[model samples]
Target: MKNYIVASWILFIIGISLLTSCEKDPWKFDTDRKPGLYFVELADTNEISFDQLNDSTWTRKLFICYLIGVPVDYERQIEFAPIDSASNMKFGEEYKFSDAILKAGEVYCNVYLWAKRPAVEDEDGKRYCTFRIVENEHFVPYMYSTAFFQVRVNHPREPKWWDAEIFGAWSEKAFQVYMRYYNKQEVENTDNWQKYYSTVYGKNMYIMNDATWEGVPALFLPLLKEDVLVPVFDYFVANPSDGVDIPEWYYEWKKN
Candidate 1:
């Protein structure tokens, strides 16, 4: 009888251990703690053709912020716009590439901005604005302009462990920890590495001509070699509109 009780207790303990080990981490899918998104528009006239107002030539920048709960804490973020389109041009207003190439008259383009939600706010909000094109006296649209695009913000995925590790690092010790465990398997190429790293690191590292790892032995290099950087090269080759290049170091590193 005593042996039976002992065996049952052992089984119970084993069951409990298995159950505890199998318990899903509550934080894994909890996006409730994510940051919020802030969107803004910036104008550029560098591409504008002075002679051809109707020509699609103006440039613009759209900024998206990923803040940590606090809206004010939002930092430098991604920018997106269209390419090679003609629309009305205003002397001082911002215009996206999509806005630049509308029909000579009035037209519309739906603009979107994506970001994370504040940790406390269950529901986020979206802001809508308009873009207008006014023709010059010649009845020919000479200037392309946009008041500002409607900035519809949406909550993106919360930062994963690796994201936090890479972007949160402020010291050598912290950086090394990021370099050691963050999975590089998903980062198939240099462009992928750049996008992933920038999303997590909060800055553009792949574009950095002189980026280097500090605080660790020189032998423990975390830099991607050129051959291994093929993915990034192929990405740029495929998507020239992205306006970024795969650095020469990546190609050099790949040859080895």
Candidate 2:
């Protein structure tokens, strides 16, 4: 009977141990913990416009952060392996990721991808690159973040009229018309012609050469439609002889 009681006690202890082992640990899949890998800007593909080629390269940023719960103090070395078959954009040819592998020891860190110029320009062709962040020893990548790792290159635009010598004479005439009306208004607020010129074109035209205006539009049409500036500009254009006559279009504009 003593032996039987001892066996029963042993079975009870075993059952308790099994129950304890089955309980979920606080650290695993904790509700409060939200550790993640992410991009700072959420887009499936980043766009590069070779047409607006003012700079040598275009850049985008990637970030990794702890959302709700911080993991144990640890550092991770991130890796990006380009999927060559899936992309026409070649690494070391068209693009590269900067600051890719490093110790991510803080709350958040940055990784950058740079796309270079003379990007394979095609009017209707698709040019792109897909890069993937592989699994590393320290952190598991969020699948959503990995899916959108892409860069798309667009075709450059051909040079237009604003890109030639015609722009200089046209800008001078437009500025002359603006000044003529300014003197007639008799409103002596000390705003200079350069400021007025900047307002008409949205940037300082004096500083920009014709080659820099390749994709830009002519200033006259936009200035001719402006409410305050156009009335004066229209008057001078219609009455270049310094007469007191207002055009029918000005009266019509004022009536409305």
1-256: candidate 2 lDDT, tens digit per residue: 9999999999999999888866765556754433555544443545544333232356454444332236345565666677787767778777677765434346555676666554345423365666666666544556444423344444223333232232222343344444444443334432543444344443323333333433343444344245335565455556563323333545455567
Identify the candidate with maximal lDDT: 2
| Residue ranges of candidate 1 with Cα displaced over 4 Å | 1-212, 217-223, 226-228
* Residue 138 in candidate 2, Cα distance off native in Å: 2.4
What candidate 2 gets wrong by more than 4 Å, as runs, is 1-23, 30-46, 50-75, 101-105, 118-120, 123-125, 145-256
Q: Report how far residue 151 has shifted in candidate 1, in Å.
A: 1.4
Model 1 has how many clashing residue pairs?
Answer: 22
lDDT (CA) per prediction: 0.34, 0.49
Q: How many clashing pairs in candidate 2?
A: 0
Error of 2 at 235 (Å): 37
Against the true structure, what is each candidate's TM-score? 0.21, 0.45
176-196 per-residue lDDT for model 1 (tens digits): 322333334345445644544
